[model samples]
Target: MIEPETVIICLRAAMLGAGAVCFGAGSAALLLAPPQVASVLRAYLQPVLRGAAGVLAVAALVSLAVQTADASEDWSQAISPSALFMFATTTHAGRTSSARALLAVVSALCILLARGNRIALLRLGSLTAGLFLASFAFSGHAAMHDEPTRTLQEANHIAHVLSGTFWTGALVALFCAAIILLRRPSGDQVEGAELMLRRFSPAGVTAVVIVGLTGALNTWLILGRAPLDRGSIYQLLLAAKIAAVAVMLGLALANRFYFLPRATRPAALVASIAIECALGALVIALVAVFGTLEPV
Candidate 1:
């Protein structure tokens, strides 16, 4: 049987991964697509965001409970209101978890309102989602370093995650949009996809660069000249993540320069995008594993 701590770790990772996809896809739709297109896309995407937010809320609660249990060594105390309040107010991890829960609640509410067909609500939802994404940097390894380095690493990690999500989430949104278009094939759908592809190409390139630079910075900060052959689980996971990202970049390049330019079959493009999204999820899962492992 898996230990409760292990379960909490998995929950944290899943929460983060789901939150990234939710926040990234929603923000990308708002930023990259026209209002009409974005609205339509949001109708499909908001439900996903709401579901992810719910998961995040539950995970945060469970994680906190686990931490309290471990710290106090008593399940009954862990579940007590007084204990929960004490943990939330006293510990950094607890505070971060509380913040995450609040953000998830706000994000979910905004997403629901955004679905009400109000422009103001949509914009608010998008901004809230971005904030939700940024919250992840407040905890984890990024928050472990001392003083100046801690601040710098946290900022870099935020940028790295936001940029990575933009790329991955945009791909997912595009894939969903593409599927809708394929089914109907209206002139507007074709034009909208084309426009979004063109707009996102430049942004995607910039995001890739940021992800690379920040990823290297993070690795340096965490590993700090250590050799991977030390057989550390964290290092092994990091290496796997790097390789997965490299493959994603290759696929993105193929889509941009080759398949995209040639107007590859819609089915083919969709397949490629789906594959990229799958790989992106794998990277997120690895990141979750990395967060749980101790770096050396």
Candidate 2:
């Protein structure tokens, strides 16, 4: 049985991962789609983005509180305003938590302010979301390294996360667009979905490449030449994540090369995308488990 602390860590990681996917992917989809399509997608996505940012902010605070409670061995101390404030202001974990909270707040504000045909507002919101996603690197394994190595690892981690989320999240948005197109069959919506898919193909390929490269870098950094022994839960989970990602990549390639050309069949395309999204969720769940295990 997993310890309560491990469960809490997994929950925290899952919330953070979900928030990253929603905000980062929404931003990417908004930027990648054509203006008219973007406007429509934005209407569908803005509420989700705002809600994700709010949840992230609350999750960051709760994570800090949980850690405080664990360290102090007193629930009251954890909830004490003075303790929370001091921790947020003083400690490294607290600082990262505060930064995540601040970023989420800023992202939410940007989302709220972003309305209508203002390209600048959209761009601002997108940039803020990216920044919010980047904040995760500071609090993860990348932060454990030293000096130049730490900077490099963090950069790679940021790239890995942003690219992964962008692909998965954009796929989700596209899936929704496909569903809308199927139900309503509007000419503009159909055209927009096709155009978005075409544009996304190249970007998706690029993002996958980056995710693969950075994932390798992260594994190397974490394992330091250690073999993937079955005794090590982290290594075992890492292997599982890699295998899941491999399958996801295979599905993506199949969708882009085969099913995509037959774009007339909306049902088939949506099914393929839906499967990919499920696999992506599995990868995220594995990552949450990874967060709970210490790397050797």
Give all TM-scores, in the order shown: 0.91, 0.89
Q: What is the lDDT of residue 277 in candidate 1?
A: 88
Off-target runs (Cα >4 Å) in candidate 2 are 1-4, 112-122
| Highest TM-score scorer | 1
The residue-by-residue lDDT of candidate 1 on 124-197, one tens digit each, is 65566567678778887888889989999989999998888777767777776666555655666666765666
lDDT of each: 0.74, 0.73
Task: Give RMSD (Å) of candidate 2 vs. truth.
Answer: 2.6
Which digits, one per residue and each the tens of the lDDT, describe model 2 over residues 11-86?
5665656565555566666666776466777677666666665666566657777666655666666689888888
TM-score of 2: 0.89
